[model samples]
Target: MALYDHLGAHPEDRDGVAGTRFAVWAPNAESVSVICDGNGWNPGSDELWGSSSGVWEGFIPGFGPGDRYKYAIRSRSGELLEKSDPFAFYAQHPPHTASVCWNLSGHRWEDAAWIDHRRDTDWLKAPVSVYEVHLGSWKRPKDGRRYFSYAELAEALCNHCEQYGFTHLELMPITEFPFDGSWGYQATGYFAPTSRFGTPDDFMAFVDVCHQRGIGVIIDWVPAHFPTDAHSLARFDGTCLYEHADPRQGYHPDWNTLIFNYGRDEVRRFLTASARFWIEKYHIDGLRVDAVASMLYLDYSRKAGEWVPNKYGGRENLEAIDFLKELNVELHRDFPGVLTIAEESTSWGGVSHPTYNGGLGFSLKWDMGWMNDTLRYFEREPLYRSYHQGELTFRSVYQFSENYMLPLSHDEVVHGKGSLLNKMPGDVWQKFANLRLLYAHQWLNPGKKLLFMGCELAQWTEWNHDAQLDWALEGQPYHDGVRRFLGDLNRLYKTHAALHATDCDPKGYVWISGDDAARSVLAFMRRTADHSRNLLCAFNFTPVPRPNYHLGVPVAGYYKEVLNSDADIYEGGNVGNQGGVYSEEIPSHGHKHSVEISLPPLGAVVFDALTGQAIPPRPAKAIEAKALPSNDSKRPR
Candidate 1:
């Protein structure tokens, strides 16, 4: 059937070495030669033995592992093409210096064999909290000299993410981008991890550490385009080897790069195989497909004759979409627990929908519009900018994505936008309060979340990868307080069953409204554990305090304020609110099924409803009763 099923590189066993033969389906090539390091510093020994197919094979001793190589391709004109580094894992300082054939069986995988939850449906039930990082930038030096080894970074970063209570780790593309500051978006090699980091094995060690700590890793994968670097997949064999010759298929105008021709069979194989290679080889938990919207529309970044399209001449690029669907389907089928997250911002249907529903099979899509809307609202001064409308404008578009992450990404903090904390327009107290509002609202929203590196500590300045975060500021009262607040927030999120339980199920949440603009207060309840469980979330955004602010509860019982962002111990003004318990009985609509509670001023609180007895979230009932199914669909927000 397929050569990939049997293809592998091995030199230990003589019989296996005999089975190892080179094959390249270059239909137009007049001649080809295989280069080998086995030959003693000579030029002619690289010549390969001609095979039945367009492939060339030979039995050369000591030229198997860690040997740099490429195919010397000859065109019909007898002209030699200065080709790309074919087996190029380490396209480093000098470029195309060497490449070693990947040995699959060498790695010692210690991952838990029993853990295999499918990534697509996994987010449907589990609470999703993502930590987005650029492996290089997140921990680079202040002097712009040292880059942490992948191993060192792995140890520190994964532990930090685990401590932060995030479920997923989304890395910016680490597929060997040519330029460092382009932030891994400009990829040159899709199959290999960046040599700038540690070795391929070293990268695997990072993933291994992540698995041990129960964190899922997702990389920013670019199937949309490639960098314009010379020693790359483009023009490899004196022609468009991995790309297309025609302008219709090869150019990326916005980024000045080479785009893949997905319609071509070999091109599809290259991309799809690259996807599987990461999931299977590195054991990456997911892939966040970058610039999906650019890939979807042919008119993207258009400049008249410089672009071309499919036969139908519609705005759509059907080939890319077709390949995307196939690739996602194949990924899920093979790995099951691997996620395919799309970074698409269009109204393209089924983005976060199931594959069976005639949609692209992305497990989740970034809720960018919601982020922009909510952040803009947060930036408005005095907590008064179309106050009532700002209350839940973000919520409308938010509920669309089946699974979404509320991201405070690097994009927002760059180019004079400032940090999320710096985006606030008030004094120190007001700033902290604003930060509280942003985070509390995010926690209450019906989605998972992603926070950039320094946002947790409320880093005042905008982000710059050229240096480490202002870690020295931890000694300052404001910074230390913010750190405590963040750490506590994580504890609160995981401890409460309602906050993250049954994320996709509507029954897990309800709106207990005090929806008033003048009062500038809104209350919602997250109900995930059981009817006996409730988390009363109330936010007071107005400068003026609401006296005797009464909020209705969904369940009829005692409720205790378990956490408060405006607590006096946390450097917040004591004038706002004091939280204990609401023991008062409520009579509303002639039904005694709900309780009344007091609201806080410029404060956010989460209260747990008290059951008569300690209520177990999902306790086993009598065996005679019909067995209730366990909740397996964890909807990552």
Candidate 2:
């Protein structure tokens, strides 16, 4: 039998009879049988004969698509085990473990336009603001339904994403998993969409609708390990078929799951094929591989002498690296515009580099350091923020390292970490202001963006996988303000070529004032490749307003205040320049011309240099900066 032949159940016609061909690799099984509803669950009736390839094959003359089935194998130790098909196209809804036979060739796709747009699009140079979501909780059905089918989620989720100006939706793992409590990380069905959200075709419809709306769908993929459930790939045929036999190499201490035997060719193929199946069958725009650090290092979460080193006596998992490279190379070769992002936390070099250049071959890597530093900084009180200003500046030391995506992922909000809004150490008004300022900094800074779902709504509660977000709060002024601010931020990011065009290039960034910790102020300039446009971004982290803050500008004239996080519309104090500020002959911050402007309390303001036109000089009196109340006691007019 060929390598593909024995992997899972496949449809076939047996001598003029409509049926299905069942095959499985049970090298250590004393006997293997295909037991299904069609066979009256009689294991002996459909006993499969073995071949030299170690695969047991049996043809069922009447079983076709949509039939429920499972493999009953007697382990070499004479223990009977019932397991779902590893390559199952569908599965029984959770609380039921049977695999459902599904034909994949039925869905009608209407996303050719989206496909063409993606093929020609350069994601690296494009704006990629992602809204990370867990499907089960993003939104539940209103009519007393526990979950929305994929089609239902598509309409609702897609609209919300587009409305908020997110370019992509990064869904948490939809790969079939048993417990919703694990949040889909512990996957049992690699090829099947969770039956919790309708069928495989329903998922296809979801992707199709997202693509049609110019939204890229990115799914979380878990290749690091699998749960040790009896009916899963674990201990298949009573042997370590997919995982390593040794506990040191196979077991994950933290997750208590089984690590894949990446050194095995069949295991590599199985994982690689699983990755390919999602993209080829569902037309997903990208895959964000989760827990990559766990897969890359041999000593991850392990004590000394508890882990096995690679053949070269190194801690790096060489086989996993090889498999990753192969997976990336093949995906890139097949899908021209698709992206592969790694949720790798360690300081691994060359993660987003090319495989041909001896790299792991990812398109982007999450900047865990930045996220940690940022959250840590924002969580501090405004008075103590100056002491930890280094947290804000240290990331720029290696900001351009490997095309970073600054992620405030779900991992940050769950398990006592607190929600993004609650993490802000302030009174209610100040908390919302701090969150708004944080988001402003996130977008204005150099890097791509990824914010978890409820962050935009400024949810007070941490994510609960079992419940929907606080939608009733959306009508409130404060939450609506945060939502509006997010929409504006996203639009600003996408609209400005300077903000996104050179996010990965060093030339696009200029540090205007990164050393103003005492004042809790920072300013930077984002430039385009051609220098045709430049946006000056300034942040006042403290609650005190600066009346005469002088910032240098590359060009002189009128600098338009393009975006202000402190604007009243976003429920801020409405403190800012009248509309735009005028630059004078005074030189500051190493620039030829500079502007002295009023700074809002705990706000971020962006100034766009007015260029390509003659400047009308402002009256001398107009250049004078006015003083405002230093304390945040001032209210919006």
Candidate 3:
């Protein structure tokens, strides 16, 4: 019965006197009191009575919503402590920490149609091109305002996302955190939206607008660990009540924080309640759980002698695994279409599989392997790329093992790691072309797509959390070209069923020419589930063009060039097949039919076969490459 009731401050009529009822968990506290603005911060005047269940409860007459408060607890060790409410719906803006009383029930939602449609939608088969955003730095005011309010952000962000053809917006954590530098990863108030943006209602309005604009929202959620702030969950009630007792299991070495004690039922319930609160009250579409690898492994970032083994003598954190499985199960059970994505980096099997099958139950997991290898492959000089072709083709070998989201996230462009455009190995002209090629490959690949905010505008510098993106670059031709290219790519991805419907199925993809490593080229075909439509894609990694490059096809037909990254509109060299090419009965790369067309340098071209007919092979010179690699530079078959 207690679990069904609100846990924090709530307005109620107590004996016909309107006041706020406050409840907090402090099992080890000798005495507890609510200190609020209405009570003039007097603790003794608003004392709370404790129950056998470990919750302290009290009612303060004349104190209602909009009042600010904190819990003053006298621990068993004779020490007094003041801490903010963990279940607070809103918090004071950082640099000043206090819980603000907020009622979560009153806001009017105008997205019922979006919510209703999502409940019955099949997200796995849907196009999910995501625009990952960090609210603080996405855009800042020109008139000296440091940050936009939630209402202001809703209009700006939704307009940008809608114009860019992004299906979803994956926001960096908005949960209450102390430091802006940590980017909300080190959360303190699990149930409150950061007041840095606006009130709880304002955040709700932001979400409502996202839904109204048909853009799904997936927020980064950090349940793995929290900062050791004096006013936070750390050492609450003069003990490690929310975290583990032993430092080996409780402390996070990498972040210098305290990890949640998943083994404790109270802590588990608290975290689960936070998850449910966001979904049920705030109407979030998904949770992209952060740093899951740190939670999954007991020995993560620790020396062999420094870490403790589990009861089974393994590195796996059993309690954390159980908690994650339960979290996914509950979320999926309650919200049918809501996604739970994992940022698990290790080769942890079954990260996205069902818990019933002895696997972690997440809807999707970021493919860290693909991101690393793909970036490494692209960052290398084109001459040296032939030796590392495995990095390009290696992903297809295991792409279908689990549900994946290819994330070019904020993590890739921070801490001296340059921006995505800067990561390419080339001059200014080739740089934009290479980035377009990268994005083209990413979208056409067999997975959902997620690109960090500034990538679309080809921002050359790494992300700065304190400053806004280079919005002025949008007027530049090269940057504007990249932006236009991304929009077109997104539109194409959304319009084609072959691109997304069977993203997780191996049957949807086939290799066309993966062995042309000598020329630094890759060709593949993406097909619909029923083989009704096929989109052929080809990429050239080097800066050298290959004119009349023969690419084999399963069927002979007129292949129309639907997309060319090298087109003049994209600020490229504009070297490509005119509009379409005809396939002849040329046995190449084990295919009976093939097309001979000019492949542009540092570009990606996609084609759709519009007609089919039996034809004979053209002359060798017509079908063969205009130039082949030197004899010593051999390509694998």
Estimate the TM-score of every prediction: 0.86, 0.95, 0.95
Off by over 4 Å in 2: 1-6, 143-145, 614-637
| Residue lDDT tens for model 3, 312-377 | 999989999999999999999989999999999989999999999988999999999999999999
Q: Give lDDT tens digits, candidate 1, residues 1-637.
A: 2333322233344655522344444545666665545554343455555555445444455565566555566766676643434434444433443444555456687766423543444565566677888776676655667688888888888778766677778888888766767788887766678877767888888888888777778888998988767556666646776676776667876788888888888778877877887887789888989999988888788866656766897778899989988888888787876767788877777776666888888877777777877787777775575364554644743464466666778888888988888888688878877787678888776666777878876888988866777767777877666667766776777677677765555777766664466666777778774555678787777555555656656565556677777776556665433444543456543334554444445567777877666432433566687877866676564
lDDT of 1 at 298: 82
True-structure lDDT of candidate 1: 0.69
Candidate 2 lDDT over 308-339, as tens digits, reads: 88889999999999999999999999899999
Q: How many backbone clashes does candidate 2 have?
A: 0
Candidate 1 regions with alpha-carbon error over 4 angstroms: 1-27, 34-45, 49-60, 76-79, 86-90, 93-97, 101-104, 113-121, 140-144, 303-313, 387-391, 397-401, 529-532, 574-578, 583-602, 614-637
What TM-score quantifies how close candidate 3 is to the native fold?
A: 0.95
RMSD versus native structure for model 1: 11.3
